[model samples]
Target: MNLTVLRKDFLAGVVVFLVALPLSLGIAQACDLPAFAGLLSGVIGGVVVTLFSPSRFAVSGPAAGLVTIVTGAVATLGSYSLVLLAIAIAGLLQAAFGLLRAGRWIGLIPDSVIQGMMVAIGLQLVLQQIPVFTGAETAAAGELFSPACLSVAAGAMLILLLWQQP
Candidate 1:
């Protein structure tokens, strides 16, 4: 392996770890799990991905997209152990899909659509952080465009634009 590539990957891994630490805790709380579980999940995910994942660039961590499903499953099952079983079964199913080469269908998506989806997801993440930026206790629906939120969002965008400059 090239030393420069290795160095860049190590730096990226550290950055991902830093970001994933708090995110994992937040995601676990969203799912009604203990904070320790989030930390453990992050660690275990890193180890498993490092050992087994086919792609070095694959990011493994808890995600906001799973929050509703996890919360609902916990509420219905009434036990974390059962939720873990469900997660294990889901993992097995995902592996089965991979083995079946189902992921090849993603190639059918147009590059433009995929890029647009990525931009949408990034915008959603930025919008979701507006309340935090504005120190709001809670953001109600339809209030994301309030002046304070917009100001913070604009400032954030400006900083990102400036930071990306050569």
Candidate 2:
């Protein structure tokens, strides 16, 4: 492998680690679990995926997308142990699907649909961070278009534009 490419990948990994570390803690808190659980999950996920996953570039970390599902599962089951059991079963099912080559079916999805989903997820993340950008305690409908929020929104857009330049 080229040293330049290796260096770039290493830098990217560092960035990912920095971002994933706090996110893992936040995700665990959202699911009403101790912060250490999130750290442990991240470590295990990294080790397992790195060793077994076919895709070398696949990312394995605490996902913001699963926060609601985890919270709901914990609430419905009334115990963390039940949620752990459910996760283990789900993982086993996924392994079975992988062995069956079910993952290849995902390649059948159209690029446009996948791009649209990515855009939607990006928008959702920005919407969720509106309150933080506006220095508000909560992101209420009425507060969404306030002067502070608008200014922050404009600044964020500017930063995104600048960051996207070659």
Best by lDDT: 2
Candidate 2 lDDT over 1-166, as tens digits, reads: 9999999999999998999899998889767888998998988998899899889788888788677678789999999889999999999999999889899899999999999977776676666566666757555665654567668778988999889855
Best by TM-score: 2
The CA-based lDDT of model 1 is what? 0.82
TM-score of each: 0.61, 0.62
Clashing pairs in 1: none
In terms of lDDT, the poorest run of 10 residues in model 1 is 137-146
Q: Stretches of candidate 2 above 4 Å error? A: 1-9, 104-166
Worst 10 residues of 2 by lDDT: 137-146
* Candidate 1 residue spans exceeding 4 A from truth: 1-7, 105-166
- Which TM-score value belongs to model 1? 0.61
